[model samples]
Target chain A: MARALAISAIVAVFLAAPFAAPSYYVGLLTKMLIYALFAMSLDLMIGYAGLASLGHAAFFGLGGYTMALLLMRAHASAWIAFPAGLVAATLGGAVFALLALRARGSYFLMITLALAQVVWGIAFGWRTLTGGDDGLPGIKRPVFLISFADQTPFYYLVATLVGLSALAMWAVTRSPYGLALRGIRDSETRMRAMGFNVWRHQFAAMAISAFFAGLAGCLFVYNNRFVSPDALHVVTSAEGLIMVIAGGAGTLFGPALGAGVIIFLEDFISSHTQRWLLVLGVIYVATTLFAPRGIVGLWTDFSTRKRKP
Target chain B: MAISTTLRRTLRAGLAAMVCAGLPLAGAGAQTKTPIKIGFIVPTTGGFAPSGEECVTGAKMYLESIHYEVAGRKIELIVEDSQGKPDVGLTKAQKLVERDGAQMIMGIVSSAVALAINDYARDKKVPFIITCDAGANELTMPGPLANPYLVRTSQNGRTPSAAAADFMVKKGWKNIAVLASDYAGGFDTIGGFADALCRLGGKVTQEQYPPLNTTDFGPYATNLDRKADAVAMFLPGGGGLRFIKQFVELGLKDKLPVMDIYAQSVYEPFLPQLGDSAIGIYSTLHYASPIKSPMNDAFVKAYFARVKHQPSDNAPDGWVGAKAFGDAAAAVGGNVENAPKFIEALKAVKFDSPKGPIALDKYGQVIQSMYVRQTEKAGDGYVNSVVATYPNIDQFWPLTFEQYESYKYRYAELKGSLTDCAKVLEKK
Candidate 1:
């Protein structure tokens, strides 16, 4: 009851953020929520499923491009187009996973990287469809969601969507299927001997992970009102990986908090000094050296130490 | 009673948001007495950082000369880096508009960034003056994306190409070879030039788009048409340097007259490295240092004295934008609150820019002279000396609005392919 009350209070604050905070902060927070959702989805694969796919951005980019083509090209409405985008991203994930699951460990990482490059190549080389290097600009949200024109209403919509996605992820990770995936991560051979369909679970996790990532991508396109090949680049995938690692992989809500840290750090540091890249590097190095388990790990460690004393 | 309480709470939340927003809303509500703030967005930390640095320096030099005051209102310039990405550029633009309270936006070096924010700027009713970025034509051309609030002071992809084609026609060069980087800008530029050349009864014997950043133009050089009078090309960044060096090493510079629209690449910062290899090369641009005019002389003198290095074409682009802003501010009597009136003043704004007599078309694009220059030996190094001039050239040169509209509609479905040459040649 106490936990539920606390969660409701947090939701209330987020709900009122758009109306109570400055407009730019609302914009910044909207970006933070989308990135946090992306990071959490990545954590599902790398942390729980023990699958470190470097080309995760392929799904993200796929979602964005699908949304763009449907709305801009086909002139489809949001309700139909948004779901179609998710379906496209899920199929893309399954297809890439088929090629990726052909190998394991380091080979799996390389295959994922190669597959991502293939997607990037298609996005870059296919000029007629993706607009090549010129990129597709001027994406608009549905007229029903005209609050996107104003910062406040858009922030509320983003917060609600992100909250639901996060809740879904939390529920999935706490389920029995999630436990079996964790068991596979610990010892796949043992889990298989115990009659667990390890490959099926991993594949299912991959599809689910991609669905959430793609949803985040849809929100991203709407937020920025543009789409480009940069969405599909390896740098984007790497950013997700970094967020997962820095946020404390395998911990629910940790990656989300981690996303907030990195985004706010970049925004604040860049505003004060142009050499924000160097500052980010320093913080990353410090995090790796001291907080190996991440910010959540540090908090749990502190709480346990206090209890022991 | 519960609904009324909920409404009151909602009103309070909205009030809080507004109060928080109002804290940083300083420069936004500028009256005649308040200082007008202009937000400058450019790539200061990316591949285009050097170009951004040069543009900022030029703008600063101009601002310092004028003492940064126009019409009794102190002009505050807030600089933000777009990082050459559309997403980053839009975010920075939002920050500038919402937080910095800038009335006008200036200095976009990337076309994607400029186009990405076009709708938002129009919606917000902010007057955006594009300082430097070329390639995309849909920005000013009549289209769904084009907005009246956006004005481009920089060259479009086809402006220089049209001027260059006219220069070639005047020179009586019947056959020309074309080369460009394999990208959108390259295709757009070469296509414009080729079409214009064909329309003028000239022949383009060969055309090639090498993969971007191709270091070895050896195979391409060997395939050059020996019968062609000149080679018209568009190569970007260090690719131009490598191509020119390789062309010189292959002993092709002595044989064929090479020309391009972006003459700044072979001039100034790159000229000394290129040495005499760049000599006699012809190119057309909106501005060149050798142009003989009072405003040009003063700008060049001031820029050279301050920076100690000769200004590239980009310096004049920044200077021209700054001049327009100052003139518009003066016309409005330092009051930027009336956005429609300020936009009208900007449309009527014209001055003797360093690039020569400059004015705006109905579409708010810079209409100015285009200079065809040859790299000739100056006091020490080489300078692009004016060989020919096309005066009062608008964005769509040689084609009237009706003609251009008809042509654009006709070719709207046509991809700018190498096949365009054969089609135009057959028609000729």
Candidate 2:
């Protein structure tokens, strides 16, 4: 009952966010939500499936670039462009899975990283198509029944989509397929002995994760109204991983919470000081030392300890 | 069961924290009689951090000169680090305008970042002053990208190189070897040089474009055309440092008369490290520390006292940009809230800056003198000695607006093909 109440309260806050806060904060909140979705999708692979892919931003960038190219160059409608971006991301994820699943453990990480670099190189070097390092700018927000040109309407639109996506992800996590994936994570040999197709399950998880990540990327492009090769860079992938680990892997809510924490902290700290990168580094170090399993893990430990005492 | 409970409690805590954070920040909005806010965005934490710092220092020096007061209003300068990312720059710009209530925005060291913020500044109607090193031509050119809200006080990428081309052709170095970093700025600069040279009856014999921030210049240095009359290069930052070192180490320095296109490669900061290797190398740029002028003398003294070293091209860019803002605000009598009047005042701003006499053209691109300098030893350290001066040079120097616009190709379209520069010259 309390958990239900808490979830409702959080939703209530998001629904009311645009009304209460200034447009700048609303825009920031929108970014936070998009990143939350991105981080949670990565958690499906890292937390649930035990696959630590370092090149996840490739999917994100593919989705964004597809949407941006379609919108800016082809002048496609939002309806067509949005779905096209997701399809591109899904196809990319499927191909990456086919190649990367050949390796497991640390080697899987390395292969994923190499594959993503190939995508990044294309975005960076292809001057005519991708605008090289200059990137494709002046991408306008989509117009539907009503224009999302204003911040408030856009925030509400993003909120509704992200909310629905999160609920779907939560349902997937609670399903029997999720249990089998967790089994594979803990003991692949045991799951295999039980007649489970470990490779097939992991591949499906990869595709699904990529789909959600793609959705996040598309939303992000709309939010920023711009996309660049920076979206595909390794730094973005690393940031996604950090969000998952710092939020507590395997918990759907954990990574989402972690994304919010990181995005907010970055903005808050950078505004106050020029040495924000140094300060952010120190905070990450502290988080690693104090909350190894993440903020969620730390909370669980403290609450359980209190109960025991 | 325990996990769900923990999640609930965590969510509640996060909610409380966010609301608390948002309320205070949003409530602190702008009011009448508040200090005029000027948001300065620069890459304070990336590869361009050093240059960004110098740019900020120059602006701060200018602000200090006027005691930070304009037309009975105190000037509040807010510095935000872009980290050299376009997305980050846009976000910072949005924050500056929407959150901080800045009337004007200034200072971007990276061209990509400047382009990213260009449209945003236009849409927001915030006056953007390009200070530091963002030398993208599209930002100031008359095209789809050109914005009235944006004005570049810094040189366009092609300005210094055009001057260099004119000087090189006059010096009988008709057959030139061109080498620059493989990017938009590099192509723009080299293309300008090649266009001017071709028009002056010179031709480029060889061209090499190394990637930005290239640590190894061994291949490029070894492969440089030894037959050309001179080698013109535009390798900036660390790449320039490395290339010069390797050029000397491989004994290519003596074989070729190298010209530092834009002179940023051999500016004051790199002179001590370059030592004798940079000596006798001719460079073309808008600003050199060794220029003999009353304004330059005072600027050099003030900069050295504050920074403990001679200023580079970036410092002057910052100083000049800030002065334009100050001059415009003073013209409007501190009524910067009147955007149209302020912008008109800004366009008419002309002064003898630390670099030289600077005035904005109708398109808001800077028109100033370009100096052809040589690296000569002064005492123990080195200085860029002005060897030739090209006065009253605009973006389209030596060519009228009609002539420049009549060209079939933009400078960036001539990448890796200096021979095609003849096509541009043909139009003239």
Candidate 3:
């Protein structure tokens, strides 16, 4: 009951965030929520299911452009478009998993990168469909009963969806299928011997992860009222990977909190100093050197150490 | 198209779900008929922010002069940062039109962004008053799908490039090497200059196309045919920031008088970045506030006061473009749908800009006076000192379709490509 109450309070604060904040703050929070949603999806794969996805933005962009092209050409509604986007992302994720399940470690990472690049090329080279390097413009986004006419309302809508998606992910991860996937991650060879089709479990993990990432992309488009080829670029993929690493990769809520704080810090720092990138690079290097387990892990260590003392 | 039952069910379900989710109905009523919103996308918050920042200031000054209110209606200039990316610019332009309720649009620094915006505006039916970005006249032209609302104030890549090249040609410089960025604007201006110089029987001894932000111009300078009579190049904004400074550092300024196609690329504001060495370079431009115009005098005084720095060739152009948009707004009397009438009024329009007189062509390109300016030291230290004026530079570049097609100039039917492009300028 206490946790449930805490969850509701979190949702309320997130929804009200942009309204009370300035435009830049609103934009930052909106991105944070979308990224948080994306991070949660990654946590399901990496944490619960034992699959790692570095090329997640491919799914994100797939979902983004699905909605983008639908509205750009066919005038599709966001209500209908978001799910279609999710399905598209899921299919993309499945294809990726099929290619990647045969490999492990560095090879898996390489295959994922190559696949994401292929998707990015499609977004870039196919100008007639995706506006090439230009990107799909004049896309009308659907919200829950009111079309998002501005950034603030869009923030609220995205915040709501992100929360719901997180809850959905939380529920799924706590279920038996999620447990089996986690078991597979812990010992894929053992799980295969235990009469479980480990490949299928990993595949399913990827599909579900892709769905939420795509949903995040869809909400991102809604928040920004724009989509670009930058959506599919490697830097974006790296950003998600960075968020996961910084927040403690295998922790469920950790990725979300990390995504939020990190993005907020980026927004604040970049705005304050143009050399924020240099500063961030220095800090990232320091963090890796001293606290390889990341912020949450380090905090946990501190609490345990203090209690022992 | 044949649809399966699942597809039909899904589409229908999606539609129903959207209704539940609250998709707003199209053609929604406006809050006010007379509230004018001008959506703008520029290279703000990036490497080009220096230029974008000045353009924004220049636009605001022009808008503020009229109090962002024209014909008793309030004006709202909603600006977005494109960050010098093409996709970002296009998406931002669309949002400004559809969501922010912007009636007209303006400003973009990169040629790639301008090209994207030019196509999008045609479908959206919002008047887009493009100011900067030197992508030639391939954006708008006369046709059924011609962007009726599209108007531009900035000069194209050809005018200045050709003028400088033609001057070099007149000076009997036979063998010239060329250097340009490989992108759309770069290619167009370089190609345009080459065409002009080559037509005058000059040989382009060597050509180099570098990436936009190549801080190292050592290879470019060393590799150049220093023996050539001249070296013509096209570069703008921050790209020009590094190219010329490094070229001079390599002692090319002493050996060869740089006949530059891109004048705005080398401005007075960024002179500090280039240092005292970046002087005496000759380039062609539409306006340099000291070019003997009442508007120029007023603009320079206002701009210098605002920036606390000497204004460059672009400051006047940005201010002039915003004023042109203001003129059209004043003529429209707050009905943006009547923009066709406003455009007709605009065709008949003559505004006192920093460049003297800005005349609209048959296409939207602004026909303006071009000045061959040499950088010099003054009380302000360094500026684009006007050498001579090539008055009323127009779109008709004395080139037949056959002549343009002789070289692989993108597409052959040059007239068909830039069918309706042009309008009038300031980058602001």
Candidate 4:
């Protein structure tokens, strides 16, 4: 009963958010939700699989620009383009996993970082195809037989997709697959000793993460109606990593809460100072020093500790 | 995915769609007649933070005169920083429309962000008056103007770069080499330079497109061994400034004359960064110190008084976009709730900007004058001194049906010869 009410309440809040919030805030929340999906996708690799991939935005933006380029050049329908984007992301992620995931820990991170930069350069240097730094502009929204060119419909479309993606992620986390994933996370050697195909499960989690990120990317391009090389930049992937870690790693709702906090902090600081980055650095540092478990982690720890008594 | 697994995913997707088919439309919600806010998205980080500050300052300056009201109703200015990144830009743009209650957006320094929001402005039915980042001639022609709510106050780099090439072509320079960053801005710079040189019967030895953050121009400098009459370049952002300094330090300036298309932040961002090394380089600009207009004098004075620095090309677009918008809002009796009415009013706008005689093109880009300015030391500081005025230099692409055919046939590098391109001219 509590779980159903919790899920229903989340859906209700999402559906009613735009009406109550200002347009900018609504847009902000939509982006938060979108990035939350991105962070969660990254967490599947970083948190569960223990493979730190900094090349996540390469998949995210490749999915975005791929969807963007196809939506315009191929005149693809959403049904066609969304899956095509996912497939493209999956292919790219598989190659990345093959190359970078073969390594462990810091070496994996470094390889992914280098690979992410290679893709970033391609986005910026391939002028004829990618529009270089100016980026691909004037991409149309998914018609979906209903003109999502309008704001409200587009927002709802994105919200619904985010909700479903979160639900799917939760479902995945509860299945037998989830138990195996946890086994890999807790101890990969233990899983391997138990005669499990540890590499395949890791690969499967990565593929799943890439698919959801690609879906989010598809929504992202539609949301902005444009894509640029900056999407492929390492900073963007880092942002998703920050969101997952800052909100509390290894939690279902952590990335979403982290995205929300970061976005609002950025918006609020930019309102007052031209030097908002300094403010962001300070905030992140303070959070790290004071609340080492992260905001949601702190709450969960406090609540669970109380419950234990 | 494996073939059968992919099939199953596809099949499940179809089933999920079927399950959600009865969802009610989310667009039926009505809008209120409250104050209309315009989201101003610009960079508040990177090397371009000053430009964003100027944009906000200019908008606020104009908004102050109107008492925060447009069309007899209240108006609000919502600000967001793109941080010069697309993903961040998209997020900020979303926040602008959905969180700030903005019906309009203005001020994007990076073309990337502007392009990203171009679709958003259309998707959300919001007006975005771009005050920075000159576009490619292609965008405003029969192309990207697909977004009706989009308008820009800056000319494409093609105009100024072409003019600089024209100046070089007229100089009868025999050989040329081009160096530009490997980006959209670089592509435009290269295109404009090559087009102009080819028109003047000059041949380019080779063109180099370097990475954005390249500090070492030594190899690029050494690559063009063959001597040319002049070297034309397009470098902007933090990269552009570094290139010019390095190019001069390598003694390339002494061998070949350098001309650039860096109007907005180049003057303020780069020139100041280089105290003396900035001398003798030529650039094309929409705003120069010697424009010789009463409106410009007032703006120049007011800017120096406020910011304690001479204004760059950035100041004019913000000032002009803000002033034109303010006038349009007043014309609508300060009521910005009726955005369509404000856009319509701005359509027929003929405001005397600090740059003088600013108006909108068919695509909502400003059809304004441009000038090729030379960098000269004036009282121990570098200033962009106007060398020649190409009053209303037609954007490399044409606006009217007649000019369109002419531009495609006569001028464009990929399409027509320089003579042929010149013949298709909209205005001289």
User: Deviation in angstroms for B50 in model 3?
Assistant: 1.9
Provide the lDDT at A226 for model 3. Answer: 59
Q: Sorted on DockQ, highest at the top, how do the candidates line up?
A: 2, 4, 1, 3
Model 1 agreement with the true structure over A152-250: per-residue lDDT tens digits:
777777788899999999899999999998999999999999999888999999999999999888888888888887788898899888888888999
lDDT of 4: 0.72
Off by over 4 Å in 2: B1-32, B422-428
Best by lDDT: 2
lDDT of each: 0.80, 0.87, 0.70, 0.72
TM-score order, best first, reads: 2, 1, 4, 3
User: For model 2, which pairs clash?
Assistant: none
For B95-174, candidate 4 gives per-residue lDDT tens digits of 55654456678888877776666666666678778876646555555654467776777666667776776777776764
- Report the TM-score for the A-chain of model 1: 0.96
Task: State which docking tier applies to candidate 3.
Answer: incorrect
Encode model 4's per-residue lDDT on A1-309: one tens digit a residue: 997998789889888976755455566666777888888888777766777778899889879878877777787777888788989888888888778768788898999899989988888776667777777777777887788876677889888888888889888888998888888889989999999998888888888888888887878777777777777889888988888878777776887778766766675667667678897897678668756656676676666877998
Task: State the lDDT of candidate 3 residue by residue for A30-115, as single tens digits.
Answer: 77788998888877877777666678889999999898887767777767777888889999999999888898777788889899
- lDDT per residue for candidate 2 within B143-245, as digits (tens), equals 8678888888988888788888888888889999889888767777888889888988889989899988789999998998888998998988777878888
Candidate with better lDDT, 1 vs 2:
2
Q: TM-scores across all candidates?
A: 0.92, 0.95, 0.67, 0.85
Q: Candidate 4, residue A276: CA error in Å?
A: 3.9
